[model samples]
Target: MSSHSTGTGKHHPVPKRYALLFACCLLLAIALLADFLWASSSNLSSSSHSSLNLSLDSSNEVVAVSVSTPPQPRSIKKKKEPKAVNRELMYLNATYADIPAPHWDWEEMPEAPVPRLDGFAIQLQNLFYVFAGYGSIDHVHSHVDIFNFTSNTWVGRFDMPKEMANSHLGMATDGRYIYAISGQYGPQCRKPTNRNFVLDTKTKQWSELPSLPVPRYAPATQLWRGRLHVMGGSKEDRHEPGLEHWSLAVKNGKALEAEWRVEVPISRGGPHRACIVANDKLLVIGGQEGDFMAKPGSPIFKCSRRHEVVYTDVYMLDDGNQWKQLPPMPKPNSHIESAWVIVNNSIIIVGGTTEKHPITKKMILVGEVFRFNLDNLEWSVIGRMPFRMKTTLVGFWDGWLYFTSGQRDRGPSDPSPKRVVGSTWRTKLHL
Candidate 1:
């Protein structure tokens, strides 16, 4: 029995080292198989999709695992939106007619002296009536020089009553009666008169009426709906405050008797402003404000002043007396004496003084023509006049725009102290 026990011990269950080696070899083979399968699945997933992933479970067994890659971001392009267009406003035609030839033709006043500067000219019954302006001696004339197109002569002269002898006033006619409103009494007078008067075309006599509520110099006068509308003149001086609009209350039967009615106050007031009645609307154009003094290079003997404020704004007065501001003028005029006429249903603003030199600060005379279209409310340059004109008295009749008694051809180096034009120029109307 001892010998059997010893032999069994010596052969110790097929050697422990060998049994341990066999177990390790089996584990290594299983690991190798698992690695081979994992690598194959990884390659297959990569070929089928964008990416592949692998993970181990709790039991440590070879398992076929799959994970989906998140979707890749995409690039997109955006579209731009369009802008809105204005639908209410209309535009005028870009083209304008050219100025005619022989722009200025001298009309023989034939009288002892020609009509002076800052005078007003109006036509009624084929006769041109010029009145109430300062003469060569700087004396305000209450005289009226009448030019008849029928006889082609200065036929008659009428003197305003002594009470109504005033210059720098507004004049308007209602076919039968010529109305004269507020103005300066004399050439050198700084005080403005509120006195109003009317002249009978048949009798050629002056009669006094109710005075203006706001006495002003160079106020605008117009006849609309048988009512005289007076507007926008200086109260104290050229830029004096308290300027306003007033209308003469016309009695249905009475011709001369009318009461002064207050209308609207002008926010910006100046002398020689342009007023025109068009399309039943009252349009007040460019105006001037500032003191007048001698120019830089004016002659020692002569005297003139530089314009300070040249207005570029335009306004229209409605029935309710509200001023509707319009688009400003492209080329502004310095002098309030901008001449205006209505032709072919459009308002034409003629020559006026320029503000000053950009460097030299001298005023200039320009003959630019601008047309305001009533239908479209747009402005266009209708070419320039043949000659420079400023502070001119203008009138429209018989299809012609007449420019008379204005300053022209003034330059910086040779500035004239008494720069006034006495010649009358006519241009045909072309829309």
Candidate 2:
């Protein structure tokens, strides 16, 4: 049936079921949107709370919030420090303005009985004893010549032991006794002997000591702490350098030990170097590595020249196993094993062989007197000698510096060769 009148335009009424369904759908949509908005707000609040930990009081008041930070990486670097300088070393500049220039009065004293090289001189009281050395015409002097300082004359002479090594002997003295160690037994460029002997200066008698395990040529020998210490020299071949060090205990001219005890090896080794005990320190200075050797199958002992390395390296041993390096010498010098004397706190080094001449390629003898100051560990050229020489025997007595018996250079300026002389000279030290 039609519910509208034809002429009047009246609208038709909605269905009750349809109206109820539309109202219910609108309410449901609103509730769903509200729930979605509440869920989004809760998620944002939870994310903000996770970063900070909040402490609340009992009244629900916020007190403090602790925020955490990411950790930083650590560095692994260190700062460097400077090295400390040793003031006692030799390279330091020394002041010597107050010191006077050495005049070297240059007086001629009584000459020795024989001209020799590579010999040993020991002063006991007022007497200066010249021991065995390489003598004239390829011969080795096996006798001891005593010089009386008071009389200024050669007082007496005595024959050494027949078995005693002549040249390149390592000698040391303890006031009354003179200890003679290993060296070349016969003469020129010969094999070294291990035979050792001790001479009583008071009784003038030679006593045999236990032989050294290894022989050395011109080794540095000294008496330290009741023991005889020997270091650095040539080996059996006479060309190779020996770095071995040995020591022996002794009391009253008698060996306390039957055999020599091995000690610390030297940093460098060769023959004709100077070894001295000063201020409780053992110092080795100015030596050469290689030396002249005898030619094989040469009946007359002809020496063959080899490349030699001369150095000025200075080493010191101050009561330890290690050897500390000190300042080197002013120049390269060798053949001065016995060409030194201790004057006060200074060591005076006399004539010796320096480096060969560059142009001439010949040996150059050292003429300047070198003074090694033990206090500051410095080296100074004190004065010049009348003549250049090597293997000189130096003695200091009564304020006089005496030198005798060495190989003198030929000609004043020429670096040709050397001649052995028994001439003696002295000068009054003004230092």
lDDT by candidate, in order shown:
0.65, 0.83
Error of 2 at 62 (Å): 99
Per-residue alpha-carbon lDDT of candidate 1 for residues 1-431, written as tens digits (9 for 90 to 100) = 56565544566458888999999999999999999999788767756875444556788765656666543334644455443222211111111112232334334333324647677777786777778676653556778887765554667787777776456778777677777787776655445688877788887766777877657777877877767888776665544534667777543222444566788876676766687778888777877776443334534313355446667778887684688898877656644443776677777877776555443454555566778888888888775665666667666767666666656664432222245556666666678
Q: lDDT value for candidate 2?
A: 0.83
Q: Pick the candidate with the highest lDDT.
A: 2
Clashing pairs in 2: none
Where in model 1 is the C-alpha error above 4 Å? Answer: 1-115, 150-152, 251-259, 291-307, 334-338, 411-418
Best-fitting candidate, scored by TM-score: 2
TM-score, one value per model: 0.66, 0.75
